[model samples]
Target: MFKPLIKKIAIRIKFLRSLSVNHWRYLFRNLNLKELNIILVSLGLAATAGLFLSVYDYWALRTPAPAEGGSYAEGLVGEPRYLNPVLASANEVDRDLTTLIFSGLVKHDESGRIIPDLAERYEIKGNGKTYEFTLRSGLSWPDKTPFTPDDVIFTINLIKDPKFQSPLRNSWQGVKVEKIDNRRLAMKLPVEYEPFLENAAVGILPQHLWANIQPQNFLLTQLNLKPVGLGQYQLAKITKNASGSVRSMEFSPNPRYHEKANIARLTLRFYDNQESVLGAYKRREIDGFSLSSPLEKEELARSRSVKFYDIKLPRYFAVFFNQTASESLKETEVRRALAHAVDRASIIEEILKGEGEIQNGPFSFNLLDIGDPETIYEFNVEKARNILEKDDWKIGDDGLRQKKIKGKNIKLEFVLTTTDWPELTRVAASVQKNWEDIGVKVNLDIVPVNAVQTQTIRPRQYEALLFGEVLGLNPDPFSFWHSTQRKDPGLNLALYNNKKADGLLESARQESNLPTRIKEYGQFQEILMKEIPAVFLYSPNYTYAVSKKVKGVAVTAINTPSQRFENINKWHIATKRVKK
Candidate 1:
């Protein structure tokens, strides 16, 4: 049996060898050099075609998928002084950390809409005077302590306390926050204020940890340096230099965070000023830096790896006419002429380096676009001159505009007061030149910001105040344009008082429905345009330089610099490829 099995195996092996030799011999005998060359060329072409197809297929089949891990280093201008949410407002570096390490009940999204952050949902009740928020389930602080209504109450009460001296005290002055239950909270306002919801966007502190600290020791406590909250990131490590100044702050994704942070680690390095910040970026020590100085734009342009994002801030700079003080500006035709005389495009190009948007009205949110189309003003010198000439204003021999009305000669002249910021100074000078070209005598009074605010603005002494106003995330015109606020403390620099305008502003402030509020604001904007109370100029853009490595950074109408971090959890430094 063993012999027969061996013979069978040998016979099979011999048959396979003879078949291979016969096949090779047949191919060699049947083929010629010309045929062989054709075959070789066909084989080469087929191999090359296959290689190309595979290369194309590899790239075509891949899709960018967000990877879970990477670190991002950013340079900040100032050192972290107070990481506590209550006191972060005083320091930008502190605010930067607090924005990442603390979660607010409500937050302003990238589009400037107020959305629930820690709160699962919120409802406006009682004529928009009350806001009730329900905390999301499973919410916990960085220390794994349960986040409840008590934490929200603790934060609001601490801000309300006069001794705490929080910068956010003014925002929550007349608002009362009450605990509804362990997972629910209610904030009641004394008056109907739709923008009151914005105040609740402040980050909440853990009641369990902060309950023991006295109000006097709030800023002095060690916890301010190592705060624990329900934010996207938690403090992992703090590295300091020899002088005890914080060299860098390293943060890791919080396990208890409601949303997952794509960036595994975020490191913020403190610098003395913007110069140092830019230097670190040039050295490749940092990947991102916020725009602080105009000169930084040029430096950012030089770096090929850096990308500049033009984020339009919620602030608008304009020439606010004090019609009560300036007799020439009292005439509606003269104010209209002045509005059309100055070129906003030129101002944006020369002064802002083309880093601004032409502001058509007080409401500067591009997303809102609430202003009426008929209210849009254009720079037309001929139209402005026609408006002025129709009102019996004539060009004097002194090359200045003069008018004779009511047996009195009124020259088209007024001193424009503004702060001595480089941009403001240039803008004022440009305005002066434009008005002078239209045969109107113009003067500029540039003063220190503090002096202008205390002496000129507070007293309403300036003929025209060239200033900027931040309308907040939600553009509330009640504080800036309401007739009630036209006095010394009022922001109504134009002293504009119209009953219809006042009603629209009040209704818009009370209207919780977004579309109705927008319609009301649009009507109010029409009145402002018809009245020409303030010459709306341009809104400056918040320019930011970020490296190409950082992804998913999208900024919209940012009321404050800290709000840029609202979508910080979405920013990722690493990525992978997967199926679509």
Candidate 2:
């Protein structure tokens, strides 16, 4: 059967091969119009199918990729003062510019996980007390100077130096740095600190350029505006107003960067306030900007071209009770009464416009997984009144709770001090009303933003203070709750003194085990809930707005506002198709 079929196929192929061009034309001419039309239609359909298949194959093989071109401009509410990382800690604009213009040994990724940026790799030794970093080989600064261990040492020393007056001085106080080789260095901490890696993430300064600058003249140096670093971008030009204030800055891609930025240029335009920034964005003067207040989101949502990113930050706001200033706050019952009186949900809904999460403890919800909803102080006016009444505090004719001790009558009235930020003012008003409903008279002391720290916070002048504190990604409660931090220059605004909580904070910082640290923080939070040192209100979500023209912004969480640029090098404003 196989031989017969093979013979038939050979005969048919030979017959077709024997047909000349004239024979084929004669056969086509002999066909009727219907057959000719059918043949033409079949050929046309086959050609169309072939074309479709070819197009589909090409489409399937190609992929959209970020192209190495385009520019991005962002609007910021303030001007950049110090592009140096050591001094940039206090200003958001400075920090934002520093993050893009400098490289660090390590950096937090989009997920808020620490990853190597300048260092090729790092080793945690000496039971977490020592961190050894090995810089990437062949890395050079914008000035063509080789990046070495000396730069890391110089940067760390500048942070530790008293003359520099770096806000980060406190964190580097007990740390010691040693240069091992050309590209390697080791940092020794006074104790085993699990968050030591976070400190390593500070941007390293180029030693060769900065070593000769006097500490007194460091801030006045032109290098602050024109810096040299191994980062994704470098300062190209700066436009200043008539008063010499920086109006806008332009940055180009750094040729010496470890990872090249897809976007060729980055521009930052400064404004006097958030309103001005938003107006600039609306006028198409900027491609992106960060929201100062969540309430602004509603107004920007009307634009179809704008995309919003609700980024979670490790920050929370609270009302800290200063028992030293107000004798009545010394009573735990009184503190608890005030805590239970304020409706946190209402505050989040009304003031934050539901852009916040109810925070029950000192830690942010995104930073710690130790939150227990049952332990939260739910708002209850009756409970607040009952607690005051049971504590021998009776409502007087003036509707203020009064308590008599040693023949002296004390009224349940205290001043609540807060910065005059619009959000805080609304929160303070809500809290004041909540307390007043429970026969507790609250006097709101709205202080200006510039004067709050010097006149109110540092002096510990307020009886109760409404404030926000950024815990950062590491979320260490030591500075905010430790007994040693109750004084000026310390963050313990509550002036809370608790030996047990202090020990737990210390232990938590030293504890390397995640589970153990969580347990320690949980216990510390329990103590805080019982003691009622502060009433935690909410953690507001940072709203970052970007034009839809840009892409590849994958940030979900940030330790600071600057960290929103964690994956910025990957962002692109132009795209191209490439074969897979």
Off by over 4 Å in 2: 1-58
**Per-residue alpha-carbon lDDT of candidate 2 for residues 1-580, written as tens digits (9 for 90 to 100):** 3456545555655665698999979979899999989867855755565565567557876888999889899999778888889899888889999898888999988989889999999999988999999999999876688889989999999999999889899889899999999989999999998877888888889899899999889999988878887778889999999999999999988888889899988999999987898889889999999887877898887889989999888899999999998879888999989889989999888888889998888888555576653477889999989999999999989888999966889998999999988899999999999999999989999999868989998988999999999887777878888999998779999999988988999999999998999999888888888899999998999989999989999998888899987578899989987889
Clashing pairs in 2: none
Candidate 1 on 253-361: residue-level lDDT in tens? 8888888999998999988766788899989999888886566797568667988887767788899999888789889889889889989999888888778889888
Q: What is the TM-score of each candidate against the true structure?
A: 0.77, 0.90
Per lDDT, the best of the predicted structures is 2
C-alpha displacement of 179 in model 2, angstroms? Answer: 1.7
Q: Per-residue error at 391 for model 2, in Å?
A: 1.0
Prediction 2 global C-alpha lDDT? 0.88
Indicate the residue-level lDDT of 465 in model 1: 85
